[model samples]
Target: MKTLLSLSIGALLAGSSLLSTSALAATHAPYTHTQFSITESVQPADILVVLVPENAGELRLAGWDRASRNHINRAIEVAGFDGKAGAQLEIVAPVGLSYGRLLLLGTGNPADLTRAKAETMGASLSTWVNGTKAESIHVNSQLIANAADNHRISAALAHGVELRNYRFDRYKSQPEARPSQRYSWQVALATDARSKFEQKQALAQGVFTARELTNLPGSDGYPEAFANYAKTVLEPLGVEVTILGPEEVKALGMGALYGVSQGSHMKAHLLVARWRGHDDAQPIALVGKGNSFDTGGYNLKTQAASILRMHTDKAGGAAVVGAVKALAGQKAPVHVVGVVPLSINMISGDAYLPGDVVTAGDGTTIEVGNTDAEGRLILADGIWYAREHLNARVIADIATLTGAKVGALGSAYSAIFTQDAAIEQSLRQAGELVQERVWPMPLDGYDGIVRSRIADKINTGSPGAQAGAIFLQHFAADTPWVHIDMAGEAFVSSASGIHPEGSTGHGVRLLTEWAKLYQAKQD
Candidate 1:
């Protein structure tokens, strides 16, 4: 085993800022600044959104006054919109109505209106009202029975709107204005909803940060730049940011991570961020693969999609940073550490070939099966570092590891591999809660597949996703761990609901939810 050389954040930041402060300011600022508030009475707005449940017998709009409800009921009857979840109806308010427009948002079966569904409803509503050019809007939370339910549902709704309003136009020299940018929100409820929504807002901002990082071009979003950005954003939020350069990584014997960066001039970076919410508790480690751009190394990606969209290869690491940001911003009472192995996989004379054998930080040798299978190799070192050096009791490593995962689960869900049933269940529940749903993939019966004749294991094997998981499992050793393959979930080809056409920032909310749950258990 190699000696772990601890370094201060100041030392790391001095040499690693590839972008200037002005450049960072232009590129890294928050994209949306929509204001939100909760009030006792419905405020005047261009539009009024009433949450409506399906009629068991009569049309129901519980919160609105009798005159407004009667007008909306007539509009609903004319539109023939059944009060199914996600069903929406908008009508021009008549002469007597106070608002310019009225929107009836369905809750489906009242019992079926979960937090997840409520978020989706908010996304759908935001998307629908985009072109309507509404400057201010009020969402009636009156139908929700009690203050607690109203707070939770309103927070969820506003979170969805915040997420849906995300726009990545940094690169656009003359971007068109989005109406969501100008709107202010009022969610009508009895009790204060800002605190709950503030927590969710932190998460939304985290997701936005992740999306911006993922969407940045490889030319601008290199390893050093990522480290610099993390230090700038996370450190202020009380995260301890430590960055290790190539020589330092080599000294630490992170050969598997270092090997991938051999071809690139940018070198490699191991970014460790600690959010110490507790004094002495063992932290949950989030290890992510941070390949800023992937060119399949010496193997070379001949396909256009693989080469063109390779900038998003670092999304897993971006998500880890985002989750940390969210946890720190919300002041969650949980100790968590994010370990990201940053590199750019390019084809060059110095590139590590497919047949090369690299030693991991734990001294396990990994025979590179394919240069394109570089994510697992880097994560191997990251997971080991987290488990051994950071004293993380539970390790969850996420990456855009395989195309086979997309083939298996499509873009709808992330693929999770874990031996622990509890970890799997918790991750699934968290993912579901945040709309970043995960489907469990088998981790067993693949021990032989990753077995190599010379090394401890091969980087990849026959069943791509399973074999990759097995190889990473060796690094985690006996520690409880879960591997999330988010290849298909990270980038979207088209805009849908809350997601735009670029990076989805998928894992931020899921990881935050899981970490919160894990913290509760620890407490």
Candidate 2:
């Protein structure tokens, strides 16, 4: 970790020269004096200055005071361009002196101060300073206050920017450098003196940890390696970790998981992580499908679809582990048992055929209608084991389980299916708060699609490709469970806001926030 940190520092300093005071002042100073024809009194020293269009002149007056025409001063300098839209200025006077730089960011219209807009502006600012060497940043809360709840909005904006600014250049030979030296950052709040920034910080740490896990390649993040990583990350937080190897899984009668692992040379394992934050409480169980690589078994996927990006099928398990890490890191007052059913689904002579019949840990036999429908197969035993053996009160399983969900929801939101509406609503609300959307779909009538003619259930849908989410819900068996199919949103092909292209690290923030809320309600 120290070496990585050192490399990061070295990368930042390599391309740029030692920053000079005058040059630094020119680049880092906040106030830009560019001319603008406005009726309001604008001062460079003010943390937040109001900008109202000439049209809506009949607003409020207390937080708004305009100087006469004769009271106007020189030209207004803008932050970015010298002659573009308007002026960019930095407030470098009394209030901004300690902060070193104060930037007057431009909004084309004064009415654009809505919360979403403010967050966008914050994100833009963070992007502009990506490689720069600025330590702590303070933005005037007034600009975003009218747009959003000041503290919450600002914290989220700060979080988005900080997370976006993270770069994984550990292996780069000669990395480019940026100015700004504070490794740690502080976002000055414009509102609410009692905001929960500490909690938010912990949540941010958890998200970062998840990002790290998801970013690792399949070779480094296989079942055994992933389990070891989880142990190393969570055990120090006082979370009890248990890794069940192939022998233990077989002995425990996790036939569904074992059947899925029959094709791969690598052994299947189940990781049970328990964080007893409070004593004598029924744990909330999180089950994740850990298919490290999926080759579709006997029902093989195309070479284009199965070769390079197959590793990301384990992202669901990554999220579960990530959420646990976050929960333990924050020391939340709720017990959580995370069950990750880990394996590689490959095709071989010894691989289970499409017509094979396998029994789950609960003694329910399932006919393998399609070997490609393997995620649900593994998760079946995992969810059952978590509920029956661990005695879970609430169970939620996440997986890149189906392509149909991607077709239904696109890349914008993950599809959620649950028997309990309350849990579904909570998860949806949490996802909204974090800007990771989740849409709930029906799970009640979907059992009919998975009903088997010969066995208790079937692993897949009928001949056609309809209702993939519904078919996967059969594995949850009657438990109060929520199934999150993050197939589309788990990994991206390009960068968007805080999410990079490789691994979106989708559910970490949402699950962590939901856990916090659940714990609060329990308390």
Candidate 3:
């Protein structure tokens, strides 16, 4: 039997308050990313953000009046700020504008603009505003709104600001001062799109939630603690959260997953959060690898540089937890199930070692080729549990599984593996929409790599790095599954547009968008 993890509800609740869980509130708070406002005219603000496109030596402000356009043109000429994609120039208290400063932002060419660029620009704006004393921003999206249809530019821009503005200040005695909360955003020509803005804002809430959970110290939660945090945030959204302790997992014959947590005193768990908005539809399962902290077991990561940051090993589970919360919050008409297998790989007398054999819940025995390759071991059980117990028709698993993945893809894109063409296309669309890029990779002659001498299969291939997606397929049986190896994408050491410097909260938006598209097609 697997060692079971238990939740301390009272303690978890205490931590929940610290999480600042909801982004639904209109008024900004430390946890709340930012607030949205729609306006027909530019409001008097500390900063006026204008989106301008490149035009050689000539500056064209076609969207504004003659005087306003001429003033901006002359300023652009004098400042020498070409409307390049990321170019920015601040005009402090320009004569024609009511605001104290006119922030001229570049957008390449107006016709060539897209949602991704707009969002990145928005994030860039937020980062700049944070560094300045400016507390309010009035965005003039007049020129770029038509660049991307479906209000995509404005909606995505707001989404990016909401994302970039997330701050985890609960633990800070003197939290760094941020202008996001005290800040006000006025988007010109968006009065009619209040509902759309709110919807995008709601999605941002999910991304922020995932970031919070991932940013939390690994010491804050092992398997049990992670589940407790999920329940605390998800229960109020009316999402049905079921916690399966190690015993329950063992009962289902998830020996492969169970064996990983054998050495740790903190019990491992599988947390399932469900949102059954449509009764007739077959549920789509989102499985995550929630390795609370990995110590590499017997195959110690003694030479690892960032071993201390292993706390973020649960980015996948956090994404799953955040996805259901946002879906339920948005009231999307899709039946969804999220399965997060939570555990911590520790060093102890009882720790599972390399060469040990573990029988998975699906009855496939996995030879422990490397104890450090613990993610797929846990995912083996999560993937099976989602398929069988949850009756999930489609399964998508996300994990920070392999170091080789980081070496291969870097932070540019998460590696996606699947033989199914449709799954790849769906995820690709979702990733593009959110700026979280996914690269499709072939599962070449990899089956032979994991062939074992003793067990039915080994946990990993010979080189042992790029085998995550391939090894996971063995436990998936006949189920059509998509594995996202986000080793490089999940945690970022440097800040980028709309994304802070840590725990990227990578899969929440992609997973959410995929479910939305699936539901739309079904309808």
Candidate 4:
């Protein structure tokens, strides 16, 4: 019986592993490769030929085959090697041949190969190779450099590919199972640039760590669990982590947050993570609404099917965690604090209802107009807590807050509402740099929509649907704050760039880049 029980437990563990394969993959050891020199005397069977394209001549030669004494038209034609931006072509040959297959990747305008672009290209290559079944991939260096820095170009390209091939799929029962039927390819880089490529790989790992947290599931990513995860990921890097539970939150009169938690069975929490890279500088605080599962409470959601995915409502909080994770991983010299207000919004007899007046942490009474407008309530408490307690100089809060943002900005860019033009510009600049676009939204006429007759303010507009973003702006309360309404971009129905269909991990990259920029300014 004991043996049987052990076997059962093992099976359960295996099953759990399968369920969290992606999560496990997030921290997997990165693939490493030694660089090799490019040779003109090459056969057609190399898996990934890295060639230096000094001019159009080198580009033409990359298509040539020494064995056949002609351009490899068959491989080019059959493999679909179009030299367009972000496109790749793969050719498979017999196992005994020089490299077994050839991969032709597009690098647009060889002259414009900056390190960033090269890294992106390498990541794209890695992403492509990861999908294939090749056991070995070779990169020809002759097709990728300017005479000024041949070694740097080679290393950058390899670094990009290595970073791109990264996947966080460790929790699966079959660890080797591929989404597609492609085999894992071994990459060979130009020998001289291997060290530089390794450094870039480390940076990519840090970036990937941040991205994974943003993409995590809410079931396993509860407030306390997230706080613990942060401690695990950052404590080793010297960041300080503090978790404020229900008792402490209530003691502090964080009514806005507590009111929302009243409906949840799970206790609400506020996680504060501090990283003091500078001795005497005021820290930038990132506050996020970590609603684990938002059901709209007594103002119950009519869209049952859609609301089922409300677990992703914590995307904003995840972004904050993700940014801090990246910053810590990179050992970035920046003073920052991440404040996450975590809870779930459910319908219960004890839940705060419409027309109810609740005093916030700041002692401002808010009349609850709609239970669905719970994000702002929690955020109100969090933002105030950050300013009054943490003594933050700049505050930014991100939330999958309102459907009105979707109606306004769609799913591409988040609607950014900020009182400070400088903060708005910085966020916009960061968003643009990372491709996580944000559009500045006006707050001028939003106050009228949330003004309350029965109390200091209403949770939402009386009209019930329109101008929700504008209504949410009132909760910021004159702080130098930026509210990112990520309702549209938090989750999506399709895939893009580095994101899959479900949670886009939308704000992670945006906030990380913004934090970096903010840190640079401080320095």
Output the number of the lDDT-best candidate.
1
Q: What is the TM-score of candidate 3? A: 0.87
lDDT, candidate 4, 168-249, per-residue tens: 4543456654332112211233333444544343344444444444445555655556565556566665779999988898
Residues 286-339 of candidate 2: C-alpha lDDT, one tens digit per residue: 888888888788888877954577778888888888788777766787788889
Q: Give the TM-score of candidate 4.
A: 0.79
Better candidate by lDDT, 1 or 3: 1
Model 1 lDDT, residue 459, Cα: 79
lDDT of 3 by residue, 1-523 (tens): 1121211111111224344322211212335535556665545567777766676455444345667767776888888888887799887777665677788778777666677787887788777777777766666666554523325556666777767877666667887765443333334334445556666765776777788778877667578877877887777778999999888877888888889999987768989999988884569899999998888889888866667778888999889887887788778888999999998898899988899999998888889998999999999889988887877778899988888887888878889998888888888988987778899987876558888899988887754445777788766777788899888677777788778878788889889989887667656
User: In candidate 3, how many clashes are counted?
Assistant: 1
Clashes of each: 0, 27, 1, 41
Residue range 20-90, candidate 1, lDDT tens digits: 42344323334564556556664678888876666733445534577765766677678888877778887
The most accurate candidate by TM-score is: 1
Span of ten consecutive residues with least summed lDDT in model 3: 4-13
Off by over 4 Å in 3: 1-30, 53-70, 80-86, 108-111, 143-150, 181-191, 463-466, 521-523
**TM-score of each predicted structure versus truth:** 0.91, 0.75, 0.87, 0.79
Candidates in order have lDDT scores of 0.80, 0.63, 0.76, 0.63
Model 1 RMSD in Å is: 7.2
